[model samples]
Target: MIFTGKGFRFGDNVDTDQILPSQYLVLPSIKEMSKHAMEPLLKDFSDKFKSGDILVADHNFGCGSSREQAPAVLKELGVQVIIAKDFARIFFRNCINIGILLIELKEADDFQDGDVISIDTVKSIIINKNKTYTFTPLSNFLKNIISKGGLVNYFSAKK
Candidate 1:
């Protein structure tokens, strides 16, 4: 499992509401709320973001609320993965539950918006230009869940 995309950078302590505001959560579905993703932080996020783009952030990304809407909306927006210094425990689990990859890399500061980055999961390294940062490798169980597009899909496939 590898992910590659242009990075979209954010600061520390980005919460669930900021990713997909609480008001949008009242909307019909994740697809509907996805249009408002990162709206509070960047008004033009939905308009400018492209599919497959990666989100890079500082420590404690997704620091508030365990609402699955956050990651669900992000997945709807085509965010395949997010790389951050660290993550809120519940948010980290939520991301994986919904099939988005989350990587922990303490040197996240080196990235800039639009910088091209590629993540090699098997190697546990994130590459940017000529620089590379190593991360803790994911367990095969976790990799299988993500590769199958989340828990539901993983279970369904076995039947």
Candidate 2:
């Protein structure tokens, strides 16, 4: 997916707690969970995102406890893409496992807040205004998983 909009910039070490506040965990549905995503970073984050908007963040995102709900909450909220330097192991896998497009930027500092970006997942390229940087594309296996709406669907389709 190509993203061309102002970024909602966040800093390093943005933990799962910040993404999904514990107070909201009492609820079960992802729709309910989304109300609290990025609670600690932006006071009005829930209302701030547009359908095609991208979340730009620093290194080591989703570093707290293992809560699959974190990325699920993001997906339900229509966060099409996430660009970060590095991601916590569980969180990274959880995101891909659930079909939330997550991109790892080798040079996280290449873009800044409000810099328009376009991510061509097919080409594994990240374009910022006039420049483009390409990385290894996602394997076809992963693509199939994403296209089928996560692992469960992918597996069910195989049967």
Candidate 3:
């Protein structure tokens, strides 16, 4: 997948709770869930975000809680790519497990808020303005798993 969208920039240690505040859990659907997405960091973020926008952040992104709902909310808000300097292990896996593309880059901090970015998910390359950076691509096998909608689907298809 090639990501084409505006960028939303943030600093380090963005935890799952901030992504989907606990207060919003009562909502049943991602559509409703998105209304409260990013409530802690950016006021009016939900209404301001455009579909297909990319989220760029510094290290330890999604550092707290093993909440699958975090990714679900971001996906619901139409976040196409999440580029970070580092990701919490569970959150990184959760993104792939749920089909939200997550990537790690050394210079993730360089991206500014509202900068447009184009990501080549397969190549793991990101282009921000005139600069281009390459990230380690997910292995083909892992890509296949994500493409098929996670490990369960990968295994089920073998049955």
Candidate 4:
């Protein structure tokens, strides 16, 4: 699978609350929840995103809470992928469970916000301008789940 988009940047240790504050958690639907995504960290964040945009972040992205709503809100906001130096484990799993793609790259700092980039998950490459970076490819199992649009859809297709 490959994804291409302009980047949206964030720093290290961005937690669930920064992604979506608890105040908005009680809101109904992913659409309502998404309105507040990154509200605290980047006011009017929802207004800045376009469909198919990419999120780039430093290490420990998604550092607090095991809230599934975090990734869910991002997905609802049309963030196609997140490339971070590293991820908080539970958040990583939650992202996969909900069909949002996350990639780890120790050299994540190489790219800046709004850079047009393309990711070739099959080749494990990230292309930005004339530069290229590599990342560990997702396993076939994980790829299958993402392709089917998350675990629920993956299982539903099987049945």
CA-RMSD of model 2: 1.7
Which candidate should be chosen as best, given lDDT against the real structure?
4
Question: Which residue pairs clash in candidate 1?
Answer: none
Evaluated against the true structure, the overall lDDT of model 2 is 0.82
| Number of backbone-clashing residue pairs for each candidate, in the order shown | 0, 0, 0, 0
Candidate 4 per-residue C-alpha lDDT over 55-97 given as tens digits, one digit per residue, 9 for 90 to 100: 9999899989988989988988888799999999999988988
Residues 5-90 of candidate 1 have per-residue lDDT tens digits of 88899999999889988888799977888889999898979877888889999989998898998988788778888999999999
Q: Give the range of the ten consecutive residues with the poorest summed lDDT in model 1.
A: 137-146
Ranking the candidates on lDDT from highest down gives: 4, 1, 3, 2
Between candidates 2 and 3, the TM-score winner: 3
In model 4, the worst 10-residue window by lDDT is 129-138
Quote the positional error of residue 54 for candidate 3 in Å.
0.2
Best by TM-score: 4
Candidate 4: stretches off by over 4 Å: 157-159
Q: How displaced is residue 33 in candidate 4, in Å?
A: 1.3
Better of 3 and 4 by TM-score: 4
lDDT comparison, 2 vs 3, better candidate: 3
Candidate 2 steric clashes: 0
**Candidate 2, which segments miss by more than 4 Å at Cα?**
none
lDDT of 4 at 18: 96
Which scores better on TM-score, 2 or 4? 4
